[model samples]
Target: MTPNDTKPSAVTVRGLVKHYGETRALDGVDLEVREGTVMGVLGPNGAGKTTLVRILSTLLTPDAGHATVAGYDVVRQPRQLRRVIGLTGQYASVDEKLPGWENLYLIGRLLDLPRKEARARADELLERFSLTEAARRPARTYSGGMRRRLDLAASMIGRPAVLYLDEPTTGLDPRTRNEVWDEVKAMVGDGVTVLLTTQYMEEAEQLASELTVVDRGKVIANGAVEELKAKVGGRTLRVRPADPLQLRPLAGMLDELGITGLAATTVDTGTGSLLVPVLSDEQLTAAVGAVTARGITISSITTELPSLDEVFLSLTGHRASAPQDARPADSREEVAV
Candidate 1:
């Protein structure tokens, strides 16, 4: 590969559209990913997120659109495009009967690597992914996290210029998810452009340099995480009174602060609180003052910015934890609660 081959814009899409019978999976979507940045495509279950990734990764052709991967047009230059992009779908694709090392070596050989080179790459990846200890074990015996790491290693056999990860950490525990996140960060540091599709807000917030949110086959919002959060209204004020009996007074004070719709609910076991969504930082401060003036001691008072889940709900008229089948084909299923 020449220096020009290392240049960016590894994935680009314009006016992309795809359909399944009467449902339009992608409707006039446009996206651009820089050479080395991680771009997140986020949406609820039905929100065309997978469809878009599928088109850009060359797994599926678009009905009416144009895309390019590493300067090769997806439709006209698919063979060349395949050489530069790596795609890991929602499920792991490794052969369970093969040992971890064997799986990696096989992929390397399939990529046309010399036998010696393939073995070397396999050893390197096993060590890099902390799988060297289990390198000889059948992949089916590996834990979910380990299997995911091996799957990722397989995708790198060709040293792809761009990587597409569809919900890479969907079923792993928190520790394993963080491990995968670290690997993604390392990839970005090494100058590989990544396009990630995930419903997890934390995943997007932690990994993506930019986010594009799809709803009903259209881009409902797109920007940096903070910028997207800002568009969803304002800060939220949460106050927990030391005495559960004081809830009524706290509610009244919140109402006096011009914050209507104040509601009381148990925050957790042995904790009672009132939550009111406020529109501004000023409202938060004023509400705090009024609560103090009422002689109610505040057990805790905090202001929180709207989360990505909140943004999704506000834009799509449904909570993130709602059923997937309830959403339109172009819409995303709510993020898991």
Candidate 2:
């Protein structure tokens, strides 16, 4: 969408809830996405990330609460919301029998674009996604990465103002994943608001201006990358010894500095290493000085911030492992709107 066409607050949700029998899929989840910015939704498996996306995209209704996408109520104005939103799920949804260009063209036509406009859009997306060289090939012949790009292109056919990408880069190589990230950046530059769901910490850090961490169907933490990391704790000092014989002295130094729970191991199989967690920068410097004074040669000393995985584990009681590849094939029962 063009910059002039973009509106602020493309998505807003409050107290959204969905249930499956006795299980609460979404427990009063609240989310907001600003216009022309990427908002990343992060969570571990069974955390209701997909359900929130589905509700906002108009695929599923909520048991309680309200949501609006692109200024239209998702429940009351489902058709209007659907028209302005594009959803690309964890799996590619392209028709294997259709050629790459044809798949995009078909979606354009489905969105009521004229034949000429549809064809032009198809070609434009084909070139934009670097699929022009293989545009005429059936989707079945395309690689996993190619199929994913085509699927993403299909969703953009109508120039959606709000896009929902649910784990869009799963199962792709690093190169292809970077390509997708580039496209997402381009979309934001062009003023399309995005809601991206993923378990990849780096992905969220790279693209999202704001992030929400969900656990057990509730938002446990939400903020910018640095802010979330700060919530987990401060920096950690890491030290690796030059000699295995220095481990004992290192432990004593760490103990003298009041840095307890110092763990030692051979990280490089041959090189001795000791990892200890200190509370502050002053403690880090004191520990290092004490070890060096004891004639211990320090191979490496560095300060490490808590990763997103560490933040998630600290906030939620579980680590953000890679999501499973399984997608429910059967349609789930609809809950109340």
Candidate 3:
């Protein structure tokens, strides 16, 4: 059985609070991460996600409440806590001039590994991250995805039990993002507990076993992705008409079907699509028949669960904006790790 197969909690927090002057960065935040699983902290920019991470990682002190990582108190055993946790932030921290192997080797030395052992560990990590071919090349010569893998490798030099990844793939291309996702999945397969902070719902859905949504310094919601989606308005039926002008006609047909509680929202002219909030599988079946009866062609039609974006809006009364690296109002200077 894997570490996640066990019942122990890897990280725990309760009634956490933090403030910078008048602004509250975190307030009564609470969460628990299962061992060897990924717990995603999902939120928009300026939602205290980073503040909570800083406190949990022992880089910053909370004003109140308690937190523990790897069974050690975050406040009282910070040094020991740091030893058991590794962190990778929004940007890569690798030195541009250093080769990939050197970066990992340097971190191992910093963690007090003997020279020969550090070198061996570096070689092992390079092979594990699939960077052995590029191991000797300057980090500046590597692509964005390779650089990110190198950064992740550096964080693992000390073999931390819990890893903290804060927006680890924020600016990468889709392919690169997937590459990093694969790496993260591989890490979890090796029993590394992860706490990933991200603003993108897709990222949370892709990697997290459980998620906690924070907004304006407080946790607005928490659950598995499916559970959280159910808390929103439930799944929706989305249709993309084959012909742009058919959108209106399709909506009219759907409304005219006399199906109870089936009201199609206005068509989005730009995308030639219409979204209908669905309360049951019966409504989806009725919708399909209605469109077919009208002889209207649709390029694509599907019922999808409420996305993380909708969940955020429903819980917080606002939609998530574009992804950014902005921090909460109470954010102060970076606390050294």
- TM-score of every candidate: 0.81, 0.83, 0.82
lDDT of each: 0.79, 0.81, 0.84
Over the stretch 79-144, how does candidate 3's per-residue lDDT look in tens digits? 888888899987889998999988898899989999999999999999998999999999999987
User: RMSD, each candidate, Å?
Assistant: 6.0, 4.7, 4.6
lDDT (C-alpha) at residue 319 in model 2: 68
Which candidate has the highest TM-score of all?
Answer: 2
What's the count of clashing pairs in each model shown?
A: 10, 0, 0
- Point out where model 2 deviates above 4 Å: 1-7, 239-252, 259-275, 281-302, 323-337
lDDT order, best first, reads: 3, 2, 1
- Cα lDDT tens digits, model 1, 1-337, are 3232345666778899888788888899988787888889887777898888777777788999888888998888888887788888666789999999999999888878899999999999899889999999999999888988998988887888899998787667788889999998998898899999887778888999888988868888877777788888777677788888887666765666554443332243254767766776666666777777888888988877788888877877766642131223333233211
lDDT at position 140, candidate 2? 97
Best-matching candidate per lDDT: 3
Residue-wise lDDT of candidate 2 within 1-337, one digit each (tens)?
4332354677889999999888898999998788988999988778899889888887888999998888899889998777788989877899999999889988998888999999999999999999999999999999888988998898899999989998898877778888889998998898899999988887888899889998878999988777898878767666777777767666665666554443332233343666666666666677677767777677887777888878878888886755333435342223321
- The RMSD (Cα, Å) of candidate 2 is 4.7
What is the Å distance of residue 194 in model 2 from its true position? Answer: 1.4
Better of 2 and 3 by lDDT: 3
